[model samples]
Target: MSGVDAFPGKGKVAHCDKEKFDLKKELARVTRERDILKKALGYFAKQKE
Candidate 1:
């Protein structure tokens, strides 16, 4: 009834599911990259100071 499922059509539902899955994967990748960057930044900051 709400959020990525407003459409009742079969194709739409499938697309929504795929999109949700893709988003989850992308989120995980981005989170990992962000964590790596934070660690690198901290390392550089420590080296600089």
Candidate 2:
């Protein structure tokens, strides 16, 4: 009763934690790609001048 038996919602908590981890990983990847696209856009914008 002192271990996992004390928390019946531990499974749900673990699932949420895993989902959060995956979201954060995807966010990082999207952010990196966005930055690259921004840089490319800037390069092309300068060509018009």
- Give the winner by lDDT: 2
lDDT of 2 by residue, 1-49 (tens): 7886787763565877889999999999999999999999999999998
Model 2: lowest-lDDT 10 consecutive positions: 4-13
lDDT of each: 0.89, 0.90
Local accuracy of candidate 1 as per-residue lDDT tens digits, 1-49:
6867876565545777889999999999999999999999999999989
**What are the clashing pairs of model 2?**
none
- Worst-scoring 10-residue span by lDDT in model 1: 6-15
